[model samples]
Target chain A: MSKHLLIVSTSTVYGKGYLGYMEEEIKNFFGENKNIVFIPYARPGGISHDEYTEIARKKFEELGLSVKGIHEFENPKKAIAEADGFFTGGGNTYVLLKQLYENGLIEPLRNAVENGKPYMGTSAGSNITGLSICTTNDMPIVYPPSFKALQLVPFNINPHYLDPNPDSKHMGETRETRIKEFHFFNDQPVVGIREGSWLEVMGEDVTLCGELSARIFEQGKEPYEVPTGSKIKF
Target chain B: MSKHLLIVSTSTVYGKGYLGYMEEEIKNFFGENKNIVFIPYARPGGISHDEYTEIARKKFEELGLSVKGIHEFENPKKAIAEADGFFTGGGNTYVLLKQLYENGLIEPLRNAVENGKPYMGTSAGSNITGLSICTTNDMPIVYPPSFKALQLVPFNINPHYLDPNPDSKHMGETRETRIKEFHFFNDQPVVGIREGSWLEVMGEDVTLCGELSARIFEQGKEPYEVPTGSKIKF
Candidate 1:
């Protein structure tokens, strides 16, 4: 079976509850699956692993799905292999990848997702689905052995991507400028998934989901905005 | 002899010419040094090394200083060691560190600065003056051999740091939140140098420079603002 993924841009959009906007779609995405192996390695606000897992569990329980953190298992690799579905929450990408590498769960997680076990990721979790975490917006709090990631998708995912505010006085590089710099070093295409937007990956198709449009960056070409519900072709 | 470093937060503040804000201070910082080697590996906007260097050269010429690009030298390590002073312009920190390591210029540059030679950096350039580039705001467009930097200073520096806008609708983590997440993994104290402000290092003293207050983030302590010209401790 081909891969199925829900790559969410963020866990909570502005003024929304945690994972609120995509709850219904997420529930239907893993229909009949009652238990999800939660990867709380990202740990937003530096919350404890158990605390982060509990937040995810509470959200999933509302949809009749129980959640268990990968850390709760003695063997994380085995836990991912036997998991009915997976939910990777967002926080810091560097720390999450570091733990993923240290636990030797990269291959097992990839295999599970490739074998049709549904997988959903928000922010840093969604970032891991790309070829590398080079485009992440998080601080490099920790360093992983490699920038290479799970390669679940053909392009890079820049979660929670925002457009530059024209009225702002800050002089930092804009999101568009940063992505263009990425093109300078790599040839991979990048998808700038905006807030409340996500990539819904079915067997062989990836569709842009949500109300807002997403930006697509290709090397040596102008980045263009694509409407929501549009299919993405790498 | 102790090092003399000028760690600027940005090359050009908004609506200012390149290096315009600190030109006179930079001139006095060098104190009759006629030649300065320029490291343009950061290459903002993905410009070529020569193009980036010329921009620096033009700015320095106004101060009656001669400039040479490190890339133009046959032996980059030798060029760094023989230079009267050093100037690292800002761009992508990853690309800058990668080149520094790849060309074996890290040790040479560090030695020159530690030996009391004047060295200046802006944005990504200044980020390297700290223990590591972990706190940079730039995108990781490329992977470097290591995240280790010059270690010219004990703590890490967060360049172009901006406070969160209370009225904004953006959902991304604020700079302060990102740095706090950094503290969860590492114990290094981080200095958030905002635009138009910089750190002046002479001998063993490090003082906040310019007209604005800089934010300081220490482990387990609330971030405090240090006024201009105040000496920083811890």
Candidate 2:
């Protein structure tokens, strides 16, 4: 039987060590289930699966959760099928997309989700939840010459949102400005997921989670925030 | 023989609209030489060649630089070879990569520069000068599912460096903080190109240009600013 789909967003893991809140969030998804099928192969720029998976194993164990190491699986397709709902740990989302594309796992994951698996995405993982993966914070880790993401959600996800940097010199333009620039070139609504915050979608219902709020920006209007447990509507 | 390569960085364009500056710059490049072959096909991502060329034509005319018209070339490789040195105006650097990659112009353009033909990337154009095209504000307009840019420079570039947004919730995390997130994952230094400032490469020398200063950030240390015309070691 297909399990619930859980996607751990890309930004939730190890961002400058800023993602300290990740374990609690991950546990929320895991709940009573101790064995998490770990996918630590998302780190880009030649990060070995062993490196990220071991890191995840340690972190999950530290959280008192048993980890079923899935990074060892060469074919993510079959591996994905064998697992319950999967947990996508965070890292460079672009790198993750590159892997998904290179390995051709996008369709398989979608199929599994449609088959009724619970999904949780953190940071970059969360980024892939949107309609277009264009809103991620991942530096085009590797240039396939363009940006391509797993379109799980119907909107773009911007992870790790926080207050602006004090020392920044780009006047009137914050990361918000940057995403607005992204919107200017396109017509997609961007979902800005701040640190400690995420949007959880279960069945037809989407709820926001975390300490801060998630902001959604559309054309010719102000960016508004979606409070925790609130459904994001276009 | 080929006249001196005239490249205009996007500092002027992305800001207050610079038809006059662009016209003057073009004049400086092709003084008395009406044989100037114009190319404005580098703005990538579903941006029609006609639309891209139209922007160039309109801007040149508005700035008073007399020009016949922009050459609408779909195949950048053929356009690049048959034409003189190229001029990459700014918009979306990642989008530019899409067009360049689809039309197979990356290697040919690199070869052209290697053979001593002038190549300039303004804004997004200037952005392509770096190792990858992840630097620009252009979101993925289309889904070729790649961001591999023409690595003309050794480091990464951040264009349209605007100041932080005061109302933003991302506290303690300025643009530097956000970019710092990238540093946590990779070892590359991000060059924040403030408006009016640019990095120019001639032969073996890569120098900064413009009236505004730039910020350079690595993983461990605090970010630093590089004055105009300064040569960055990293």
Candidate 3:
């Protein structure tokens, strides 16, 4: 048993139905694991866990899989241990991580995933698979006990990575600039995945998927891009 | 003596020299308080405190004020108590707040401002004058001890607030959506100040300054805009 994860930048791409853009890949990733424990901690739009879980359940059902929200279980830790697969949806990363910590599911879920329980995450979900949630673009609507995340990957994930708009008049720090600031105090490498792109990790191997090139920011190095299908070697 | 503060959305508006756009207002806000202590903890672009202070010193020098970085003092608390005024330049809010806590400056600075120290803040600086840094637009590269801030105003300030672009194909949550998510977990009202705009606070009175309108988001109420110079009552 080895690590198997599908870390997605977004659950829904612009103009695409929920998970429609990655339907083929998702189906392939789940394979025969039909019972997915949906971690709806990252409730996008602040929807309830049950409501967010239903969105994932309906989408997974179309692919012949059954989904259940982790909150629906009597014991979330036990639920993680017994689940055949996992799917964490996107929302506010801080809220999701806070709930995960509060439920004490971080270790259980990490153990399950490390033992080859299939895991899929989009945006905020994808963020936790990294070293820490420090690079996430989501607001700190809530505070997690720690920025430390499940070390499923050696690097951090910056979801929804946007290129600088040279024509814009906005003074907000660009995604690249923000990451640069992170490197000032942090030493971890950050993989910035754009919309419609994802990282497919099988055991020790991690590769960039989808049609777009992903940006890589390493501490003390100039940020660069790795084309689709390239191995993300930090 | 009364609460006197200048909370700005951004330190520099697009196409304007740093502090150039609000020279008159900044001068008026400072009045005859010429000796200023600058908090460079935000450290935009990861510059050292001394380097960041140099930037502010040069800018304020144009206005006939002598600026010194707080880091220069052996006792920061004493520096706050003895300074004629204060100016906190913008960078990363988490970093700023974290350093403030690390140095035990939050209480001193808040008390100083409450006693009419003529405090001015741009971006991250402006954010701390509010109830919490939960509504900031900066990345949480570093975790502060707490999200609690100066509470100079009753509401949170979402500095560098941008309106949703109807034409955007990107799926990231808009500023409005993010603030809405914030309300789901916290009850504090949020003031979304755009670039070139600021809030002028005199005692308990807070009025929107600059030429642009500011958006206000209150829990359970739809976000609405109040024109420039309008008293932000909600």
Candidate 4:
């Protein structure tokens, strides 16, 4: 049993239906894991856990898998230990991480995933699989106990990463600028995954998937782009 | 002696020099308070404290006020206590608040502003005047002891607020969507101030300043627009 994870930048890309862009990848990643537990903690639009879970349930059902919301379980930790696979949807990272900590599911989920239970996450969900949730673009609507996240991966992930629009007059810090600021106080490497991009992790091996290249930022070096299908070294 | 504060959305608007757009307001707010302490902890682009202070020094110099970085003082608490006024420049809000807490300056600075020393903040600076830093747009580059802020105002401030761009195909959450999510967990009212807009706080009066209208979001209610010069009631 080795680690298996599909860390996605977003659940849906522009002009695509929910999880439509990655239907093939989702099918291949989960492979025969029929009983999937959905972690809907990152409730987009501030919807209830049950509502968010239904969205994932329908999508997973289309893939011939049965989905149950983790919130629906009598004991979430016990559910995680018994589930064959997991799918965490996208929403506010602060809310998601906070709920994860409050429910005492961080260690249980981390243990399950590390012990070869397949896990898939998108957006805020994908962000939590990293070293910390510091690079997430979601607002800190709620403060989590700590910024520490399940270190499923060695570095942090910046999901839905966008390049600076040179033509815009907006003065807000661009994604690149934000990551540079993170480097000032942090020493972790961050992978900036664009929409439709994801990281495929199999045991100790992690590779960039989808058609776009990822921008890599290290503490003291210039950010560079790693092409699709390349191993995410560092 | 009243609460004299200038909470601005941005330091530099497009096509304007740093602090140039609000030159008149800055002068009027400070009003003969010649000795000002500068909080440069929010170090934009990871610049050194001295370098960040130099930028503020030159700008305030043009306004006929001498500025010194709070870091230059032997005791930061004492510095805040004695300065006639203060100016905190725009950068990462998390960094600013973290440094403030680490140096034990939150209480002293809050006391100074509450006791009639004129205080001004742009972007991240403006954010600290709010109830909490949970609404800030900056990355959590550094974690502070708490999300609690100066609490100089009853509500939260969303500085450099941008409306949704209808023409864009990007999949990221808009500023409006982000604020809506914030209301899901937090009860504080949020003032979404545009780049050129600011709040003028005088004692118990908190009025919307500048030419643009601000979008106000309260928990469980539809967000609405309040025009310039209007008092931000709730």
**2 against 4, candidate with superior lDDT:** 4
Model 3's lDDT to the true fold? 0.93
> In candidate 4, which residue pairs clash?
none
- Report lDDT (CA) for all predictions: 0.92, 0.61, 0.93, 0.93
- lDDT per residue (tens digit) for residues B88-153 in model 4: 998999999999999999999999899999989999999999999989999998888899999999
Regions of model 4 farther than 4 Å from truth: none
Candidate with more favorable, higher DockQ: 3 or 4? 4
The C-alpha stretches of model 3 lying farther than 4 A from their native spots are: none
**TM-score, every prediction:** 0.99, 0.70, 0.99, 0.99
Full candidate order by lDDT, most accurate first: 4, 3, 1, 2
As a TM-score, model 1 comes out at 0.99
At residue A61, candidate 1 shows an lDDT of 93
- Model 4 Cα lDDT, one tens digit per residue, A83-117: 99999999999999999999999999999999999
All DockQ scores: 0.83, 0.25, 0.84, 0.86
lDDT of 1 by residue, B86-170 (tens): 9999999999999999998899899999998899999999999999999999888888888889999999999988989999777
